[model samples]
Target chain A: MDFKKKQTEANLKPGDRTVPERKIPVPHRDISERAQEMIAAPYNVFIDWNLNPPTKDDWSKIVTKVSESSAPAVNKLIEDLGLTVEQLQIGGVKCYRLTPENIPENHRKQLVIVAHGGAYVYAPGIGSVREAAMFAAFGGYTTISVDYSLSYENPFPGAIEDMIDVWRAILTEYDPRSVAMTGTSAGGGLIMATILKIKELGLGMPAAIAPSSPWADLTETGDSYKTNEWLDNILVSYSGYLGLAAKLYANGNDLSHPLLSPINGNLEGFPPTILTSGTRDLFLSNTVRSHRKLRRARVPAQLHIYEGISHSQLSFDPDLPETREAYGEIAAFFDQYLIW
Target chain B: MDFKKKQTEANLKPGDRTVPERKIPVPHRDISERAQEMIAAPYNVFIDWNLNPPTKDDWSKIVTKVSESSAPAVNKLIEDLGLTVEQLQIGGVKCYRLTPENIPENHRKQLVIVAHGGAYVYAPGIGSVREAAMFAAFGGYTTISVDYSLSYENPFPGAIEDMIDVWRAILTEYDPRSVAMTGTSAGGGLIMATILKIKELGLGMPAAIAPSSPWADLTETGDSYKTNEWLDNILVSYSGYLGLAAKLYANGNDLSHPLLSPINGNLEGFPPTILTSGTRDLFLSNTVRSHRKLRRARVPAQLHIYEGISHSQLSFDPDLPETREAYGEIAAFFDQYLIW
Candidate 1:
């Protein structure tokens, strides 16, 4: 409480010390009601969260549990947005195609490929298609959601290969210039890796890509991984299942492999990218770092960080203004870049 | 700790409720030592901060005290950067001209006009010239530091008019297209208002403007005002001196007036802009909102947010990498837009 001493200490160069402790309280004003509630909710307060599933089968059950739980919201979103969803087999892989009631003239030729996020192992089927449906309903573009291979049985190259296969299949029907891709969290990370794989395979890049709250760095190397731990309501810490999932996805691969963590990849000639994350999002640093990487490569990139939401929470409820604003930024970015 | 019930609650619509509680701890990993130290510092833990100065004279005294205290560090920065500072009278107002040790040939014609940050009432003289020196030293461009009229004696139109006076004077000798402007905090806010006034007065826009952590909204309207209150080491809350300074600067005028808060101004055709803030910066939402406004107006804008920093704390030490990166972004943005 000695003001003068603390001020002097602040002016001094920081030295090594034991971990400093302080408690942060939820902001009661300025932010929206939904944001406040999301931040205030202890969504990741599981005491058993540190325990990883004992086997791959256990991980599959966890994925199923999450997918089943998230089904109602995806159904609600589809109903509210007046979108039709259908299962498809594309490139010999499972996929979901979402179509809006009317395709506007300008976007008639455009196709959006989406990679859905549930870390790397969860959110199969409809859960994996939620973001694609949102983009389709909001942007009026026919969207394809790739149900990439989960890490429980297939890892690393598996998800990346599934995405590339879908991209190649889409390219046969749609022009590459008219194609755009986007996803959230692990899906965000996967799409980035997919683009890298596409580049490696000499498959052209999409017109634009939006990686929202990407878990771009599998290694806990971003500033937010630490700063936003316990603060971000979801993905509360890399120490939880997120860490276990990162290892599961790596499956003995190097965490720093550009394919595993695209931020470390050669980003030169990457497509125009628009990134989204909230102030309290655990992947904010990931998004920020990715934006810098794109900018460093001289690629046109736009970063939109929402006020106080956490980890893809903007997509949590389609009714939130922040949700609309987040999508609007992405849609605008795409409209500017994506070819008809 | 009941994950199942909490998950259900998270899915429900957020309704009216009592203020929720949370306790955020400092991240021990993934961020720079300096960032960790700055975030962990108890610099703003002043029990007496809620009290404001009773009179304009008292406020002036506080300003002088702050300037005097900050002089040592500013002096160190000048010496470290090998920058030479001189007093100048431009447009019949006091200012400082900062010259780097060697002005590179390409930058000889480039002028960077800097407005320093101090909440509009503090950091007069050399303290006010620190940011200009840093920009000049790092960017290798000759810079002018505006010693604008303070709110204690002159408010509202006073600072804006002074900036315009200086701009008009600079325009007589230097091509506006060859010039760039940068500032932090109030300086950030002031430069923005100045640009709006420049547009109103038929003066051509500068090549680019970099507003680092601008205090663009005077109404305490941004989400970070509450969310980053105590978390941001500097400008801990709006209820303290910052709130008083806001009122003093507004001088009883509506805080929402376009010139008072330039985010509300017509930013159409505004020059290329680069904005910088930090994850923990109180002015982060201000920067984010300003970027959105500029983007909405179709202005070329880029936003760079540091991992874990507070309001204008990047300017505190020129030795810090974040400081270098922040200025580098501004410099690169200016270089891309400014005519050689």
Candidate 2:
């Protein structure tokens, strides 16, 4: 029996007194019949609001809270996805390894190393660092995210050193050219710095890198710090929030030191890079400038800027079309450069 | 052996001539010292631009293209997540079941049935229908999404009849009160109609219902269809695109027929409802009005509106914090009432 037709027939009877008028005086609405032709219509996609810059103290508090951010619920999320979660001590540094349950034999050697971002603080352990690598694993890689020490105590080069050590240890099992490195925000910058450090120490580089809205310059020096200031919700401005992160991580060192801010370092031989940012990201210039520098240095680089998004917001949601597009691009880039 | 200290000392040599000036003339940037105050600051969170509605034919083309939208990559996404994908025929109707690889014994009877949105036209197959049920599976239920007949061919009573048949078959296997129904856009509206039909037929009501920005009023009769016209990127305006979906599905039926538009249906016993929308959703009024009707009828109902988002954008991104928060809430709601 077609219950739908029966229901509709029951609801409407011509000239029947029982079909009541709308109970409330409904607000006036435009009818679809009046939809005039849109001549090259320009549409609004998302909220485009701005904010007043945060006070230094306010900025510090915000940065501190972010650094201390933890996702207690993420382990369950990883488990629910059925990925194998393992905690490994590499050269005395903590790293969480997420291996997809099954894959083609040829895809086995491919690995994606992630450095979790918390402005070089926060995300202090394996639990907090899971969100960053979840995307890479979901992108179909055996992913391992380094749980580096934060600047709250370790400070400056300490986080970078931890990542370098983890990388050095993992390189023994996986070919350098078969691996990819990725990070976001401070973690993004850390990947750049770690590459430079590895290069300086004469170590091999990964095949590719995907850095999402990297904080390349830590000295509050990019144009985005002004133009897109307060437009980005996460990192409001370099001067307010990021500068605090810069100082906390720098530990009173010169802000432009190559090891602390990779934007100031040489870019001549960097890995094939896929960089990302949003129009409203405070680190927009960091991405644009890095892409230009890599190109000028003859390093192959691709930049993907998402419209109407803030720093790393796309990275947070794996289910978003943009997130899939973003990570899918990264995966394809790796597939091109690596043996996968 | 302090690698961090050694790395920092080597990078910084005070008064060294090798430190280069910035390669690019960066724009004037703001400084942290001048963050005066944000006294009574109003934050802009979304894009609020307006546009003239598209011509009827142009609108229809766009809507048709969107309705025919399919996620070709979804099956891979599911397999990568390690969820078991199974297809079943229930009373000659097609359904795709995505069961978590390792569900606790107690949770097996609990199921979330999904009706995917595409104005009743999109997500055509097992692959296309994955997005609708991903959240339910993430909520730790054995999830199954119906492959209901599309309006493109089946139209009107055809799709709803298929749903009723599938629901009836599934109900025979699992308790109705342990099931929760969900959908978005046309799919969302379908769930409402299905629940009403089930109630009319004296079937036990599901534990809860979560409809994301449902198109409850297909009549172009809601206030948001006018106010949010051109503001919502996907829908833009009801007159432009959605009215096409309405007409195609109505198949000569009156727009206000309760089966065609569930807002006209009874809300007195809608099961516990959690309705979702965004400030930019064209269906904001549908969700709001539905919530209001359920409350007036003394039915337990809750509404969630994401700030600066438009129509199912939260649903589109699984990685989005809003997506997690949304499904997490649904899962929790189901947990409270369902015996499992």
Candidate 3:
């Protein structure tokens, strides 16, 4: 049955017009459309969707199973594709590179890595990778974009292992203090996960990390999930999320585990962090919860929530004023923490 | 005649010398003996020797003449005296009541008002009615303490102003945020002179202010005066400040003129401020210039200097945990701004 029929059967009472039925809004429909575009855009090819084509009866279960399976598949795909190394390496893993030819010499010494978002189901896509490169070139930093394994094929350990390899390779060459990591959406989730992993391995932390509209909690405990269901311009409904990608990524593991859901992670000893999100982003709750957790942990975290921007807005158009401001703030934050 | 020759004659040199040329730090002297007893023991009156009496050279010709005529004969005999006012009226111009019971509820509001140091002859005296009451009880606000006037009547604004009127009244109120204002030496010059007076005429800004090692420029421009003079502890050297205070608070008009000296009249719109000073208490240069100007301008100001603290030690007091962690950080700053 559709969600509406299920709700009606579960909650409806005969002759109870007084009890209003929850109705999905138009904005949610619009967001779903945008999400589809974001997922299907040409730049997304680098990320293996690892989707388990739609099935009948228990739609939710099917999607969850697929998401879990996709994780390892994403890992195998990365290997089978023979993704080329692009010069820059950290901790012995190949990190994609943006050339110094585009960036000024003074700024080239700096590096900014942009991690892609897919709730751990996808790799860094071309658009996000290019955006990272553009930001590095304009802001005077060498940029690396990582394309990690997704959930459907490889599941839990697949993405984590690939990311660690990439980080180790990069750390081998660059001073940890000179590096800055930033990401949006699922990409944001990975950036944080990467930090936690690096810290565990006794590696030096990056100078700073900026996670925009991060999905820190896969458990969906944030108030915004319910309050902003239809109000947000993007990720309006958790149906697609809780039903599909989240389930796939969990791969039968407890979704609340810190490694799987970093919002619950022990954030002590983390470097200064900056979080940015918009009121209209579906993941607003995730961003706020993460920021509050960081603050309570005394992690020197700063959160700047834009009034009305959507998820991934910063990378979508760097020409926009808000995007520039966000980027500038990130740069300034780096200037304070990361001395050349 | 110059400080250099006097220092040489006194046989004072830098670096852990047992006996310094200046009597301020007499070898084997209990530096805090009197202060400790005053702070520890309950006493109605307290006094300390070498409290760095203002020098005659600090007064301008006109101020010197006024001092000669207005000097109280009994002041020379008494080291220090403490009194509570039932109501002290000055020249029938401004009236203030001293009774703890009579102080209005609003006037009783907790607040600490520190007197500016300018070796007296400059800022308003304890007896000056408006300086104490208006700042303390006016506009439904309560303030306590006034540094008693000091100097050539015994030079410039004296220590009496700081000890008696300002500090005494302020002690009645003890709320930390309510308590504000400080001064360096020279009664710490006028901490409120800069922003308060202007604010009183409708330009008051800032709820609190801090002037560190001020230079309430009595001589106008003593940026680096007597740079090569005696080994000065509290100031760059004493010659610069001595010449300046003497030039500014020369006569009756000079002492009262808002521009020349603030000690004599009209201290309105002053906020709570803090000032810092040190054992060296290098006469005028350290406290007079920046602090007096703030008080004259009617800004709320305070000064808190360490006994052995050098000039501007508050800013560099990370070694002293209290000083470092409690320095006026953004949280304290927000306390003032957030209310408005």
Candidate 4:
């Protein structure tokens, strides 16, 4: 922890230097105790992934396991929030429609499209509905959770195409000005990519988008990859499964292609955006860079960074004050921008 | 940097665990070479002070040495930016007035006050003019840099009182609506504190303020204090001179006093504000928390965080793209809020 010592020239490239290993305890700061416990817990998804990538069957099995384990909690969340969920296929893309028991009058006609985060590989089916449940519960709006093609079966243009189809289909029933998008991690990145495509294909733009800890940069780019490498509890480093997942999803496409790394996209004419990330999230830079890109293009943008959080952990518990505040911010933003 | 392994129970507090020492190369992501070179260099101000705080005389000598060392570059910056510096006394507080050539027609009647940062102990005289010069050059407004009493010579209320005096005197000649304020690090904290005092005294508020890498929380009450401890490079940790400086500044007063730690202050009436920091900045959380507090109070606030840079290193070199962009953001914020 002594930062006074200077490293000697060890023949390492500037980008090749490693941050030393040290124990980072949960900071006793202004964050909630629940957040502290999450930080104190072991880093999430710390699997000893081998050199070879997981086969599609392996990924499918993993996804199924994760989905089964998460289903009970998602069901509880749906029931606790007085929401109803129905599986449907819109334009051949699988989706979940979550409707709250009591929608606010102002939000009765508003719609929020949800994209779930799973590294573009894991978390399918019921596992993808947790965020939708929280959005429905907190924002008091009907939500549609998009279940796009995972990289294990399909690759880059596949998820994008599926989301485009969903967006196109959703627009027929709801006013584009009443539609907004929300997602976390890979799902967050997908929403940004979907917006870019929406703008490019001449589809009407949504009112706003909230991308939480968006994995907007597919490559191991950005300072947080190095600074928050091991510090982040989830998605600890790009060298692990995150990098593999990025490669699988890119499917030989340049990772920097605006669609793969939406942070590099032309964000002009994009809708108002509110991004959320934690200080310890590995994609902290992705969220930060995405915010900067939006601001540079004169888009109205707001950013919320939670203390001691890693990845999309804020979405883990809707009862947490941080989660409530985040959803409140997004809802308020929607209220300001979404046409009645 | 494998995070797969959990730490063994080593009888360390969650806050006492040290981040392992590793070489952190300048990220090859989206930062300028100058910033990379800074991150690649030895940590700034890495002193070998013994296990005792410096005496006032020793502190004065240290400040003078730093000021002398920084003088040449500060002078060069003033000349290159075509700014004129004048010494003056307003309300018995020593100050530097920086006037830019070719002030914009809309900004001819506006004024900006600058507070220099040195952990509240250093950066006196010409050393304090760099930020003021940058503001004048980038913002095209006449700026007055307040040279408050150093904490070594005078503590908490000293800097606050001096700033309040400067504010009162400046307001006599300039409309509060046409004036703005900015500072870096300790100076940033001072501006926030002074504004709190200004409001308490029923003085009108400025149009906007930009505080870059503000040390707003004196009690090490944020995640960055621990997560960015050594990685920050500047103000390496609170246990070092930063802690000592905080103690000296607070004297016997409580560290969490709203005037000392403005992040906890009632920020309801704060003017439109913009905050800037970097991912590696030790005060990143301070900036984040301040923005959160301001937003919670319904104040319009924006945050800009550069990649890889630490502390207020953005103000170290005027020619760096990051520095130019930071100043541009501040200038634009001022233009949007300051009355014409």
Judging by lDDT against the true structure, name the best candidate.
4
lDDT of 2 by residue, A51-90 (tens): 1224445544544454444344566567666788788898
lDDT: the better of candidates 1 and 4:
4
Candidate 3, B10-125: lDDT as tens digits? 32221111112111121111123333222122111111111333445534444444334433421221112122333342222222332222433433544434454343444343
Query: What does candidate 1 score in Cα RMSD to the true structure?
Result: 4.8
Q: Which ten residues in a row are the worst by lDDT in model 4 chain A?
A: A4-13
Candidate 1 local lDDT, B161-199, one digit each (tens): 899999999989999999998899999999999999999
TM-score of each candidate structure, all chains considered together: 0.83, 0.44, 0.44, 0.93
Give the residue spans of candidate 3 off by over 4 A. A1-52, A55-94, A100-108, A123-125, A241-243, B1-204, B207-340
TM-score of chain A of each: 0.93, 0.79, 0.73, 0.93
On the 0 to 100 scale, the lDDT of residue B280 in model 2 is 47
Count the clashes in each prediction.
Answer: 1, 17, 148, 7
Winning model by TM-score: 4
Q: In order, what lDDT does every prediction score?
A: 0.80, 0.65, 0.47, 0.83
lDDT per residue as tens, model 4, B206-324: 99999998989999888888787767665666776888888888998999999999887899999999999988888999998888778779999888887777788887788888888
Q: Each model's interface RMSD (Å)? A: 7.0, 28.8, 36.8, 4.4
Better of 1 and 4 by DockQ: 4
lDDT tens digits, residues A1-340, model 1?
A: 6543443354333332112333344544335677676766664532233458989999998778878988888888888899988999999889988999998888899988999887788888888777888889888999999988999989888999888788888888888888899999998898898888888899877999999999889998876775565557677667778889899989999998999999889999889999999877889889988887787688888888776677888766777766777788888888998888
Clashes of 3: 148
Q: What CAPRI class is candidate 2?
A: incorrect
